[model samples]
Structure formats: C-alpha cells, structure tokens
Target: MVLNLGGFKFEWKQTSEIAIETDFGINSQERIANFEALLSAKLGSQSINLNGQTLPFAQDGQEALKPLYALAELRQSLPLVTGLGKYLGRFAIEKISENRSVFAPNGAFFTQTFSLTLRRDYDADIA
Candidate 1:
C-alpha cells in the first residue's frame, strides 16, 4: 500500500485488504476490524503512530492514548455517511495532557491516554 504520510513521502506496507472504490467513497477492512469507506483510497493504510510505532485503530484502551496522528478506521464511521456520502475526514486525537483526570475523568486517570475521537457527533464510525 502507498500512503502520502505528510508530503509526497509515501509508505508502502504489506497490504491485507483490497482497496474498494464504491459509488461514493473508498472502503476496506484489511486494516480495520470491518473495512469500508466512502472514497477511493488504499484502506490498508489506516493506523496510528505511537511512540514511533504504528498501532491498530483500537487498542482496547490497555495503554495510554498518545498524542499522534493515526489512520482513520472505516468501520468506526461507515454507518454515519451523510450528505452525498462524504466519508473522508482526517480523524485524529492527541493525548489531553492538560485535562488530566482527577479520578477516571473522560475514562482516564492520572496521565492516562485519551483519544480525540471523531467529534462526539461523528462518533458512530471511528470509536
């Protein structure tokens, strides 16, 4: 798979899902638990860079949510495709260091990792 990480600098990984160009956006499950999207993109390139390591979209909340850019998981947002099927959005979240939980706040405690998930309204797919 080819991914323009930031600039034209792309990343090629051993892809497991086939890129799907549907009537609206792209879709693929080779990367997410259930692959599907609205545009035409290599679905296998969805993930997050944590401590310089790429991690799955969902990590079972075992470790802290790091403040880094990650690939958007399709299944986490497919059901909410609205208005001409606009399913492409740069979904990301950084660790809320300032908002440290006093006691299990935002599902966190201490300097716990928290995800800046697709805004609450768009939480149907990427959460």
Candidate 2:
C-alpha cells in the first residue's frame, strides 16, 4: 500500500513481504533461557516495479527510485512505518538492488525493478 522513509512516500507494488525474527538460548544447568536479549527483529525486502512509458507511469518510476536512493545515502537510523502510519521500528537501510530491462527506442529503460532491505536498530536501553 503505502511506505514512508523519512520524507519520501510511495505506493508500493502489489507484492511485498514483511518478516520479524527472534532468538532464545539455553543454559547447561537448567536448559532455561540464559540470554539477556531474547528478541530480535528483521525486515523483508520491499520490491517495486516500474513499467510502461506513459506519462504517469514513467514519472512514478522516478518517484519510487528517489526514496530508495535517499535511504542508501542516509546512514543514520530512521523511522519505518507501514499500514497507514503504524510504526514498525527504527531502522537503517541495509541493501538495495535494481534490475532494468526492455530498453526503449531512445535507450531509456522501460522496465525497472528494485528491492530494498532494512534492518532494525535496537535502542541503547534495550540491548
């Protein structure tokens, strides 16, 4: 649906996945939880496709790419939100990948795909 990174916003493509991860450790004596940190978090890639050469569609591609580039440039932790302003967590952009295909007559790309990965940043007091 909608995704925002700092000041950029876009309507995401139809296919996307979100994942969260956690961990637990065992002790030799009691086989009980032995780790001070019991929870972990990770985010799945957000993918989008830009296609067509029409007025709005071509412009949408540029708009989507702008935020992705901004995330990569900004190394500091930033807020990530999804589902109509529900706060997911603070995170840093870990990686980004782009695929381009089907060049136009003028050598402009007619189809583009992008994938973005974000990693959670634990608070100082929590971790």
The TM-scores of all predictions, comma-separated, are: 0.18, 0.61
Error of 2 at 72 (Å): 1.7
Candidate 1 Cα outliers beyond 4 Å, as residue runs: 8-10, 24-127
Q: Write the per-residue lDDT of candidate 2 for residues 4-114, one digit (tens) a residue.
A: 656555455522444454323332333446635433243223322222222224556434576567767978667776648887667677776776677777667766666
* Model 1: how far residue 114 lies from native, Å: 17
Locate the minimum summed-lDDT window of 10 residues in model 1: 5-14
Alpha-carbon lDDT, every model: 0.30, 0.55
Lowest summed lDDT across 10 adjacent residues in model 2 is found at: 47-56
Candidate achieving the largest TM-score: 2
Candidate 2 wrongly placed segments (more than 4 Å): 20-58, 61-63, 124-127
